[model samples]
Target chain A: MAHSEDVDHTSHGQSMGLLRVLGPAHVWALGVGIVLVGEYMGWNFAVGKGGAYAALIACWFAGVLYSCVAMIDSEVTSTVAAAGGQYTQAKHIIGPLMAFNVGLYLVFAYTMLEAGNAITLGFLVDTVAGMTGHEGGLDQRPFIVLAIMFLAWLNYRGVLATLTFNLVITAIAFSAIIVMFLATSPLLGAGEMLHKDLMSGQASLPYGWLGILAAMHFGLWYYLGIEGTTQAAEEVRSPARSLPFGTLAGIMTLLIAATLTWYVCSGLLPWEYLGDGVNGAVAPLFSAAQISGSNALVWLLGIGTLFATLASANGCINDASRAWFSMGRDHYLPAWFGAVHPVYRTPYRAIIFLVPIALIFALGAPLDQVITFSILSGLLGYTFMPINMIMFRKKWPLDTIKRGYEHPLHPLPAISLMALCSVTYFAVFLGYGTQLIAMIGFYIVVSLWFHFWRYRFVKRADQFTMPWPRPRGY
Target chain B: MMDTWNYIEYGAWALSALFGLLIVIDWIKIDTTYSEEALTSSREGELEAMTEKHRLEG
Candidate 1:
C-alpha cells in the first residue's frame, strides 16, 4: 500500500505536531460541550410538531439511537485513533473517494452548526436584553462575525487552551441546567404542564406519525455533535481507552440532561406557549426562569446560554479545522490548510480558513435553514459509520486490531443506527424540502471538485493510495 | 396507543435510567490503561515514528 509522503512535513521554519494533552475527562468534556447548547434551543421546535409529549417520545428514541451510535463510534475510534473522526474511519474502511465525501459532510455539518450557534447566540443576547426590559433586539450579524473570529483565534492558540476552555464552560453549562431544573421543578405545577389538554385541538398530533417523524430531527439536537468527540482521538492520551470512556460517559450525561430538561421545561409552561414565539428555541430556559421569578436563576440560565453557545462554537471550530487539516495533510485539499503553527502547535491556517466561511454563513443564512442544513449534512455523514463498522470488522477482523472496546452486539448496533439515521434523513428531507435539495446540490458540487481537481493533485503527489477499493474507473 | 403525555414522560425517564445504568457498568468495566502495542498503533505514535525516520536520514 502506498502512503502520502507528499505532505510538506514542515511548519514554515519550525516542525509541526498535534500535542497529546487530552485524557478521557477532556474528551468527555468536549463531547458534552459540543452538544450542551442543544438543551438551550433547537429541540424546543419539535414541540410545535408533536406537542411536548410526542417531542419527548422522539427525544427518547433519538437518545437510544445516539447511545448505540456512540458505542459503535467508540469502538472504531479506539481502533483507528485518528483525527477527522468519521472521515478517517471511513478512509480506512471505504477508500478515499467516500472518505472525501464524508469529510466534506462533516466539515459542512460542524461549520454550519457553528454558524447556527452564532445565530442562536445572537438571538439569546436579544432575549436576555429583552427580558431585562431593554427595548428591541440587537442586530446579530456583526456579533456572529465577531464571535466566529474570536473562536478562530482561540483555536489557533492551541489544543490545550481550547480544550481547557471547553471543559470549564461545559462544567458551568451542566451546572446551570441542573440549577434551572431544581429551581423551577418546584415552582411549576407538573400536573398542569403535562395535562392532556395541552395536546388538545388541532395541535394534537397535527401531522400524525409524520409529526413524530418531523420531531426526530429536532430531537437530534440533544445529541447532534457528540460524535465529533472522536475527532479529538488524535490529540488524546491512550485514545483506545479514553475515546470509549469519554464518548460513552458524555452520551450518558446528555441523556440525563435531555430528559431532565424535557421533564422540567414541559411542566413549567403550556407546551403550546413553550413551542411558540420568534425566539422559540430558547423559550424553555427563558420561560423556566420567567415563571419561577428567580432573578438569580434567570441570570444563571442566561450566563449558561452564553457559555454553552461559546463552548459549542469553540469546540466545533476545533473539530472542523482538524478535519480540514487531515484532508490537507493527505492532499485532498490545498496543502496550505495542513500547516501547523510553530508556537501554538495547532492547524492555524485551517482554523483561519474556516473563519470567513463560517462568518459568511452565520451572517447570511437564517437560523432554521442553517440548522436543517447542518443536521442533514451530519446525518448523511453518519450513515457511513455503520457501513464502516461492518467493513472494518471484515478488513481488520476482531482478532487482528487491538480494539480497546468492542460492541457486544457487533453488526446489530450498526444496522440499527443506519436504519434510524436513514429514517431521520428521509424525514428531514421531506420536512426541509428545498433546503435538502440545496444540500444535495452542494454535495454534488463538492464531489465534482474532488474528482476533477483534488484527485489529480493526489495522483500527482503520489498519495492517492487507500486501503479500501477505489471507486470504479477512478 | 401508548402515546399519551404520561407515556412520553415515563418512557424518556426509563430510557434515561437505562442509559445511566449502562454508564455505571462502563465506568466499572472499562480499562483506562493501554498496552504498549496499542500505544504504538496510535496516530501520534505513527507520526513520531515518521519524524524519527526523517531525522535519522537527514
Candidate 2:
C-alpha cells in the first residue's frame, strides 16, 4: 500500500544548524558524553566491588553490540531519511498505527531516560557535598527539575547550540577523567588491575558467561542516545555523507575513552575499599577519589559526572523534541507540536510538552527501572529497524546504498549483530524480572491504545495532513 | 592554544545562544525563489509540446 505521497522538506531551516559551533572532534566528544558517561555511572552504582573488572568487560562487549545497532539505524535513516527518525522510518515499513504506537513508546522511554540522567546529576551533587562533610543537606528532586529546564532551554536554541554544549561539557568531563588517570598511573600494577576472586562471588559473575551479557544491560544503557545524532541528520550538514561518518567516529572515540578510564580505575582502587556495601552504586568513583586523596579530584569528578549525565538528557530532549516536531508536521501528532519558534527556528511547542512529562518521571519514577526500560526499548527498536534496512535492500535495490560503509562483512556482520542483541535482550530479562515486566507492559499498553486511536479513529488519507498552511517558500 | 582562557564551562552557555542566532540568520537570509534553470527547462518543454500540438491540430 502507498504511504503519504508528498515529502515536504518543511524543517526549521534547510541549512543545517550544526555549522554554528561544532567541528568533528567536538561532535565526537559530545558522542562520548551521550554514549558512555551514563553507562559508567550505572556500572559504578550497580556492580559495586566488581565494577572495574567485570562491569568494564561487559560494557565493552555491549559497545560492540551498540555499534551494530547504530549501523542498522544508519541504513534505515539513509533510505527513508525522514526528520521523524525511527518513528517515520517505522511508519514507512509497517503502518501508520504501528508507527504511532512506536513513537509514543519512544517518547515515554526517552522521557524516562531524561529523568534518570537528571536524577543521576542530583545524586552526584549530593554525593560530593556529603563527602566534603558539608553541613547543609542536598535533595535530588529540585535539582532534577532545574536540570530538565536548563537542558530544554539549551536545546530550544538549535542543533549547533546543543552540540556545542555537549562538546564543551564533554571536554571538561573528559579532562577530569584524564587527570584522574594521569594522577593514578604510577600506582597501577598487574595484580591490582587483574584481581578477580571467583570464590568470593564479588567480581566474578555467578552465571558464568551469560551473566556478563546480562550485566551489559547497565553499560549499554548509557550509550542509548547516540542514534539521536543521526535522527538530526536533516539538520546536520550533508546527511548522506557526514552523518554516517560522524556516527561511527563518535561511537569509536567514546568506547576507547570510557574503556581506558574503567581499566585504569579498576587497577588503582582495591576491591574492598572500592565498595562500601553490597550493590553500592557510588563506590567505583569514590574509590578513585579516595586513591587520589585530593579533594580537588573528588569535586571535579563529581561535578564532571553531573555535567556529563545532564548532557545525555540534554541530547535526548533535543533529539526527541525534533522527532515530535516532525510528527506534528506530518499530522501524526497534533498541530501544536509542529509550531517552530519564529525567532529561533526551533520546535518550541514540542519542548514545552516534553518538560512536564520528563519532570513527572524524575519526581515519581525509579531511576533503575527507567534505565532498564530504556535499554530494553532500544533493543526492541533496533530489532524492528534492521528489518526495514533489509527490506530496502531487496525492494529498492540500490547497489551503492546497500553495500556502502557497513562492517565489511555485509549482511553476515549485521546478522551477527542482531543475534548478539537478541541474546543480550533475553539475558537481561531473565536477570531482572521487574524491568522486563515494566518494558513489556509499557509497550503492549501503548501499542494497543494506538491501534484504536490511529487506525480505527483517523482515516489513512488524513495521516499526512499539514498542521500549518503550506508556506510559499521552500 | 597555551595560556588561553578555558571556555569549557562558559562555552556551554554561550554556544547555545549563538546557535539560536545562526538559525535565525539562516531563515532570514536563505533565497526561497525557484532557480532560473528550473524555470527555463519547464518553458522549453512547454514550448516544444505546444508546437507539436499545433502541428497535430493543423
RMSD values for the candidates in order, in angstroms, are 12.8, 10.3
DockQ numbers for every candidate? 0.02, 0.03
lDDT of 2 at A468: 19
Off by over 4 Å in 1: A1-15, A186-207, A277-281, A459-474, B1-45, B48-58
Q: After superposing candidate 2, which stretches have Cα over 4 Å from the reference? A: A1-30, A45-53, A186-207, A270-283, A400-407, A456-474, B1-58
Estimate the TM-score of every prediction.
Answer: 0.82, 0.75
* Clash count for each candidate, listed in order shown: 0, 1
Best candidate, lDDT-wise?
1
- Write model 1 residue lDDT over B18-39, tens digit each, in one string: 5434433432232122121221
Query: What are the lDDT figures for the candidates, one per model?
Result: 0.75, 0.58
Residue-level lDDT for B54 in candidate 2? 87
Worst 10 residues of 2 chain B by lDDT: B36-45
